[model samples]
Target: MGAGLPAPLGPGGEAVSTYLGMPNVRPQPAHAPAHPLRWGEPFPEAAHETLANGQMRRNLAHATRTIRDKRLRVTAELPDWEALRDAGAAIKHQVMSELPALLVELERNVTARGGHVHWARDAEEANRIVTDLVRAKGADEVVKVKSMATQEIGLNEHLEAEGITATETDLAELIVQLAGDMPSHVLVPAIHRNREEIREIFAGRMADAPAGLTGEPRELAMAARAHLRAKFLTAKVAISGANLAVAETGTVAVFESEGNGRMCLTLPETLVTVMGIEKLVPTFRDVEVFAQLLPRSSTGERMNPYTTLWTGVTPGDGPQEFHLVLLDNGRTKALADEVGRQALHCIRCSACMNVCPVYEHTGGHAYGSVYPGPIGAILTPQLLGTGTKGSLPHHDATASLPFASSLCGACYEACPVKIDIPTALVHLRGRMVEAEQRRPLPTGWATAMRSAAAVMTSGSRFAVAARAAGLGRVAARGERIGRLPGPLAGWTSVRDVPAPPRQSFRQWWSQHESEER
Candidate 1:
């Protein structure tokens, strides 16, 4: 069969052939489906709300700074850090180029090892596959490894609606779940919550939490440990997301700090992992490159405390049943974009979030996705087909994400795989502008830009506008424009605007030329 052919199914409903391929082609969208990738409001409105919360800003600032500083210290230890980054980027690019073949090989190897591989074109299919798998096992509740793929699909919510409970095993994830809050960071979901808040959540929510549980880290950890231990022991099924999967050996890896992943992976009788198609590496040896880069870029540790690798299922030990759900979930759509496709190279290390000044002030909730910060700003839009025809509306929440950034390149610098996020942001911005222009009625932003263009295109018009701008000094307070009367008020709402200079550069140049003459 050709690479574009869908895999044939067997008697057990699992893919019977290795033809489960996703060719580098963009599918035509009929309409945008509602998914967990975006929600609530547009970036600017949501950010305004989040920025008003002083406690969240303080929590994010302290947590991000600590992680950022540690990452710097540990990454500086290796002289080959840049070389390793280059190698990582090269490997990912190669994977994207040869993805169809790699995926077929991966499915073939995984199936050969007694593991079942199921393909999902979007979030709904993936959730149905998992829910059916859990129902087959007669499992009412399942323990979970922290997985962004699962979060992106809103797996927990789906499970709950089906009368099945999915318990998060990661410490941070458990806190967010118990508190009924959305995750604010990629690695640290509870980054928006401080120690005292966590302690209060545990005290009120955790049934087994010790009395008078102090806000100390150790005490909080032990409380979470005790709570999750029971779930780990009793749960018959577990769901996880893969950090990296190897096509050569059909091996999947999950790198985490605490031992929760180990328990969740091992103790359960049936394991279901929902993984993005872009998470694959070509060979087992290629895992070494990411293993070196991920830890240093994420937690600032030289190595993860627990780096778990499992190949299919092993009898008489570990889970006897394993199912790997390969999810596209708009990945193929993203892949079709030559520039935006690099967003798939993200390793989920979250280095970009730590260094983003916009994210630093507003935090991940403002981005309104499970994948937040700089990565989310670019990744969410592409996944949602923001710039594509028949996708979400131009003024929708996802459309506003690209403009959330200040064009700072800190995210690109911090990325382990070296994704040029700034370039992608600019590219998406242009797409959004085009989308806006196609609207039946012109928007205020579009009108402003057209007006500016009309003035800027002529020397006389520009000179006239410059003199008019100088009149703003009448409303100035000590060389700073604190407030503006009309449409310009929004610009000065959050920041001070300097009064326009008395002399335009053109005027200054004219006077200088006269003096020289």
Candidate 2:
């Protein structure tokens, strides 16, 4: 209220909240995201590290399989499941087609309803807007529901920099936050950690973890419940990400299995929802389609346990003050691509990730982005710009991501909204190749591909190359070539390549047929 003091969130501020009583220093950007989900290196390099972790592989395998079976069972119960998928995708398409007009309408409606709507072109602006709101509340601590948009913008770290603390309320997210680790899966962030590892993380890091904690699920839930209950009762502000934002009604919908999101939505005096602009659906009716599709696809539940819908502010029922930060962060640019635009239809159900062979083996960390699995491979590169090559924040991790998949089409089949992830993967790979073409010299992969193309384009050249392949006979032992020289060595690292037959199939056929002729 004083002249020199900060203005009320009339919107943006700075400082760090102490995490777990560690002297709150001024907030800094997220600890240089150098982990699997941070886009620190090429995916293969990181995947190699992850693949070497046998425990992580087993953890991912077990979790994905269990979730996959549950999803299949629930989804099969709907006789018109495909129809629901079609409806959801159609609504998303309409949203994209009318996004500009819809967004303007959303702003008007939200403003009319007494909520402040802020448009952010990128992450820094969104972070500033949120920090200012927290500052305006004169609140040092805030509780949060699991929100992908907030994570994408590094909200927690940004708040920390300004001396504000944000605590995650979702149980899995709480585990990840306590362990100081990056999320390894989409719906289940800590899926990479087994029960024992989670217990260790809780015992070692959680300030309020029970004195003697067991690796049992019930105990962990109780411990987190107690911790969040205290925070929920006292917190003045809450931050969340929306599962769907209805443009027609100016309402945001969140489908959560845990009741934490509900508490965050209702308990706080100030609620800030940071949502991706692409999350908008054309009408509230579309929710009917997605409400079913999303739960079955994401958590494998017939219906999510908690469904919360809020619009603007209410006098006494919920938060008296509300802020909505609609984030762009490169979504509009991605929408420009005809083939790639379908990637935006994702509702974060994470079905595609559950069925992906590469994701199953490598886990979410391998992709090196907040969004992991098949979706991350396509989405992260476009959001950060495929050019982020070095150690910088938002370094382009696209080059490694498109290649992360086996192109088996499982992700496409599993996608609830029919994103055609394989098509997007190929489109992005082509873009990567075209980008590489502008260089002075072709890359090794490009060179090999070109050579193969040269041989295959002409029948005579192909015949000559088929004969030349016989040179591999020298390296052959018994029925297969166990090792190869040059760049080809990587192919034989784990599996044997069959050596060219002593006589090519074409040669044997031509010899007998020529004599017959």
Candidate 3:
């Protein structure tokens, strides 16, 4: 053990004598409470509407391309990038397998360090806890760090309904909040809006914006800074989400590009951090792996400009009161899934989203979840229990998420922890299909698939179907078929299909054999 590291202790308060390997596994909770993973329309329907927004599409394309190029450049500078990824993945895997023991150890250490630990089974529980904590401090408003966990639980809206104001300190988050819009990207929430549009938002919604605020990045940033500086100084409480939590030390860390996160961590009298259960690493040293992988993968930088870490409250320095809420809204349920569990390895880097062709065009809004893009496609469904038993009903919006990707394998390559996203996608798709099979009334998709299966099972039937497909050439203009009829029309609405060849492969093969003879 390191000199300053605390000795590992078991539940009985004595120093643990064993090697402290993976602990006895506990059964996953039978039910996962309702979460805010999905909303509004299904992915296909939402994508259709978003695809028509030419300006949004252009904005997303440019922003994603720029970020992707930067990530490639920075990652190329590391000669041991793949090794780092492997280390990060291994650390996370160990954390998940030994989660039960780690959680107890984390709670013990955090309590010893003068911080309170709260366990929340769902989003509602988490919101109630945070809201009550703020009210106890007699605070009506709180400054916030950019936190995905809070967003996943709809904490801001919940606070508003409870008569509390939550001011987002992250520039992009503030923009989204002022515009009353959902975040479109993980790293850059306002990515779907360009500078001119942002200037318009700031001028219209920001109360203290200068009379002639320009769209230049510097001007916009200064305007936001002036507005938030007052809030940072005055707020009594702050809320944050942890990028990584060390079970060994009971320490929580938040990484950010801007300095706002540091303000949130230091200036406030009370700090509340909401973190997902899966964000734990067994030891403090394990953080070294992600400290390297995350910055380059997320912001395309050598390191984050601000990385705030706190073990607990510090008297006469920073927040005097600290609370850590460990939330398991749907994590245990997701962890139970053997094949789909890999989705939990995500570090919220958003590197996969930057490289995704689908997200580049349709944007994150199409996914209809707090998490968006390729990772969202697989993560949201499992978290929402889309096709799982004893949970929420199989929602069309959540089930449709798995099919949102093109399975281009770009996400897997871009993932810092090496999550096999494509495999998880295919596995979730199969789960969705199985759920569909149980329905008494068949959907159009299921019916079509069954019919095709029957026809393809027999040689004669397949041959006849092939010949019938040739008739489709009549509807084709040259080599492309436009606007297919009836149920298939949806396929051609966004993409053109190639016209069938003049002759089937079987017929061509037969002709060639006869000629050779």
Candidate 4:
């Protein structure tokens, strides 16, 4: 099935290999039995523990850092990168503010081109729409292009319940699918595993996997190509996520390193695309900026290998039936936030995750959601709202995510859409501290701050407080304060609070002046 290309009839007297040019294969979706329970709980203790594995951490660190390095070098080549970023942000903000109207326009354009558009308010609706679309075609199987939105909505699992199967055709997605695991990275879904783990997964899991498959990179890719070829050629339906959808023409675009996305988009009789409403770009010209920004930021390449574009259905060619499922799924809620709302500008290049120290250490699963890294920290809290099953609302252990950065601001610099992540982190931190505080700040703390504010405002009070602080410091010696006796304990737990200086600068200056005289 993997070796021989399956020739399917297209136009008159023409046959082509639909699924990566292979025969007798079928794309089947990985089972997602536990996906429902995954909702509500932002952090699953089990997934948290899974991230502790040194092997996964090592693999992710190496891969992400390598990609980050390449991205930096390539991004430096352009002097106007910042200009492009601002434009991307501005365009996205415009879409977010006017999503409903833009979506309606998009529907009109798509429908004019013979495409059907479906609106999904949330994950369940999105899944139902896609599942029903496949069922309507009487298809038991469908092929998929790698998409974070589908993962968030658990589309594969949803289809399984309705007796439909969806198989992933991308190489990394195939590895994740065959291993019965969740994707831990955005651009590279299987980044946590090395070639050895991949070899084991294919050998152990694939029913028709060639015996004694070597761990060579080329060998593994060939194996996946063989496995997915059957699915691509035989499946009646294909599902995908679009990187950018042009509102002017209702044209959807997907950028990918591998040619698999192209194959998936074109091979099936029916095509269903689930895209976030925020993905809309005002015009085709806007693609110029993203086309340059995305590939470099994501894969560290100047240009992606395959950039696929389709406007509805083409005459007698490539997926006669086309459905666009515009997914909201809490995006509207994120949009409503004024300060935190800039998160929607994310291009999903994943440059933020690659440079993130927290992501390097904890890996993606610790966040316990589809979107991970800096973007996830802000996006997840807002999308799920404050009080999810967790006690802390946004203050779950993932709250630790905001603190994960050194406040280096590298993420903001590397961001393609110019999201101010440090600013967002600070904002989220305020929310977390407020959530953890329960009642208003205590009277004593409030009074202390007031006293400090007054002292700083008035020189006389300032001098008095400085003298008092100096006296306390002299009494305490030079030892670091591990715990504060009063309301300041939270500050001392994760940090060493330095004792006050022995003398105020004013006193020292006075003594020096007298000595000089």
Candidate 5:
């Protein structure tokens, strides 16, 4: 463990570094939160560590800019892109309202077609179900198709304890797995690592890697391919997460850039899928809307390289045995809130992450969730929840996530489903303040905010404070103040603050009106 860093207990009950080997896993992140994403450590401290890495910042800047540009180009090619986005959001909204009925119908249809449906209210149940299914198939190892749900349940760690190995087949995920690291991006797990770093990881970890591996992109990809091909051919069971599960046909969709998902789904004899309860669409037509939105918004492609959909077992082709695990994990609680439930509409296009400034700087591990970026800031806290009166109580660091962003709404503009991320951030902040009221006396930021609120509530007091702020010119150099004293120094340490004007805006406007009169 790093010096002075606290060790969080790992899934196997062993003491591990706060960061573990993987970037996202915290030692023991609160009293056993069910989801893989919930870690109690505040995001700010972790962000500090990532900020110190010049290479990480460079990698993220290039990758995010590339993806963002491509997405714009492809999306502009379509006249109905906005319409498709709106339609996608509406379809998901409908799914949330009718989720129960849709789920039951999906289960019935899936079961009738020779599939088994398992309902898991939380992460533990989902892991147990998958582990037991692998055991039932008499398999010690399973190949994976890069499912977010499995990561949510921390299934790989659980399987390891049960003496099972889960091989990740996606190229980025392979890099992450071989490096014993957590995924840093939804679509690109090792987006933090450049080609040179990838070459190092492959050369060190992959025994079959070419003798003289180079840091070229194609060579790196070929190395990953060779390593994964062997796993696909011999693995008896495959596990996946669905992009969208259609209730009308009981079909699951898997969209990917590479064909690894195809190999994992077809080569294995037994296939098991762990899916979030909110991943369903009422009909395949609704899936059509997301298909258009997801590919363009996420990968900047009009069509994914592979769009695989399956309904249960397919006789002589594909996996003969199929299992569908419906996971709640805390989504139901998130749905109860009128304002916040819009988060459930996310299609995991990852457009939000691709355009996030904070994510661009800190990378995914800072959020300490399998689901990172802007969505993670809002979604992770909801999954574990603030200690609000009626909800599940956990005073973990996920609470700090609401303030992770610059309130830049680019995430919303990039979103295919139009999740109002800025609004959710503000809403969660309100909830955090309310939750603090019920706890011990406010401290630090909360106390500061309360004091500010009292000062600003009345016009006379606000004017007085505004006049006092003018005195800040004493510390100013030109129009900007480079540093500040006391707790305010934290803001100035990173970025300069503008010097307060000689007069407040309200005063200036009033004086102008009086002069005219």
Candidate 6:
């Protein structure tokens, strides 16, 4: 362990120096409740306003469709894609089921190879561990590769509180950091902004930037490179998140399109990685499936531009010290639910969000959680639990996210691990509806639903109600009904209601039966 680093514990414990600089956002995040009960509140009203950003919608639509099409084509070429997906799922499940054991094995090998391992049960603990490790080495600055785990845990924010500056090496991440904006996309954090916006960010924020830095890819790369080069060369510590950690050799794998990760992962004197427990694979043989699945699934490439792996440390090459922080952070609870467990099978690919209509419209921020889109609907609830006031509880708020899909099953078919996203949405909806009934609703709405339930449950009652409904529809003529009163406002807010039939189905059925007799 790093000098003076505190022992790892679940939550609300004294944080050790090795786990330094992590801020506790809360003892319990809103979406992560302590119990299994469902909460009924819908998504916040802000969702509607954000969904109206036509420019962001256009950019997202263009990028996602282009990537989605390429992914489908590449994925189809594999004769045994289903089998490969099944293998990935099975492997993840097995490792998570025996997480403690695999993690122990990983620890043993890492220690033997001159690396240190730390266990963190949640986001706070993970950040603290990384920050403390960096601070202990007396390094006031650190470089970072693109790491979703680090973002989810808010590691940069933690480092900032301790007066340690962390420079992002990834171009997209750098742009997001420079602009002081939250990441809105998994693959492209700055997807909401156009090239001109990026140029503006660079021009305004970067010192010693070229006067002629255009929005061109190469030019932008050069601008970012020039800014990051000095930081990378001078920094003594680097932080990262691993795509896959091989338990057999304690090797961590990082895949990137740019060479920035290579610079961060290799150049620093001390390297600290905070990775999810679910990121482990049993052996190198498993790489064949994931290496093929990941690039195509994520970037729609046959192979990523740079795939870096390091086990412990090399005597004369790379960092002299390596520390791996294995994070759990509600993963165990997620694993406990059989139906919801498949969410752990995700490889952080943005494919689902790309094709997600709701995500395209609202962008990732409105999901109001780290995880977003179809994946967020299923994942946020599971990770945070449904009983709390967090993002998962707000899943139905967008109300549009579940209905956003044509239920075309493209997300499931597109998933590298083959998660059934539509199925997960239906399951979550049932939970939401049941929660709505369990709690107190407005008197008028509750009474109407109760009365309707009674009428629908009995044949005789339904017959009478249907006839009354038919009379009301007839009075309105053949034109579609555009409005509704009382409890129906939630449904009618975005869509017009169709008029009821002039004749009830029961009446037609009875007449047909009499004719047959």
Number of the top candidate by lDDT?
A: 1
After TM-score superposition, the amount by which residue 376's alpha carbon in candidate 6 deviates from its true location, in angstroms, is 2.0
**lDDT for position 492 in model 3:** 99
Could you tell me which 10 consecutive residues in candidate 5 have the lowest summed lDDT? 1-10
For this target, which candidate reaches the highest TM-score against the unseen true structure? 2
**Cα lDDT tens digits for candidate 3, 112-198:** 999999999999999999999999999999999988899999999999999999999887788778877778888788776666666
lDDT for each residue of candidate 4 in 176-223, tens digit (9 for 90 to 100): 788777676777766666666666678878888898886555566667
Compared with the true structure, all predictions reach lDDT values of 0.82, 0.78, 0.81, 0.73, 0.79, 0.71
User: Which regions of candidate 3 deviate over 4 angstroms?
Assistant: 1-39, 387-395, 470-484, 492-502, 506-517
Which pairs, if any, clash in model 6? 5-18, 6-16, 19-128, 19-129, 30-389, 30-390, 31-390, 32-384, 42-397, 43-397
**Residue-level lDDT tens digits of model 2 in 98-173:** 9999999888888888899999999999999999999999999999988888989999999999999899987778
Report the lDDT tens digits of candidate 5 across residue range 357-461. Answer: 999998888888888999988898889775433221222467778878999899989899889999998998878877766666555556677789999898899
Instruction: Show how many residue pairs clash in every candidate, following the order shown.
Output: 0, 20, 0, 9, 3, 10
What CA RMSD would you report for each candidate? 10.9, 8.7, 11.6, 7.6, 8.7, 10.2
Q: What tens digits encode model 1's per-residue C-alpha lDDT throughout 87-108?
A: 9999999999999999999999
Q: Please say which candidate is ahead in lDDT: 3 or 4.
A: 3
Cand. 5 TM to true fold: 0.84
TM-score of 1: 0.88
Model 5: colliding residue pairs: 8-27, 8-28, 9-27
lDDT string for model 6 (91-193, tens) is 8777767777888888998888999999999988887888789879998889998887887778899899989998887766776788776677777676666
Lowest-lDDT window of 10 residues in candidate 3?
A: 1-10
Error of 3 at 195 (Å): 1.6
Show where candidate 4 strays beyond 4 Å.
1-51, 388-404, 433-517
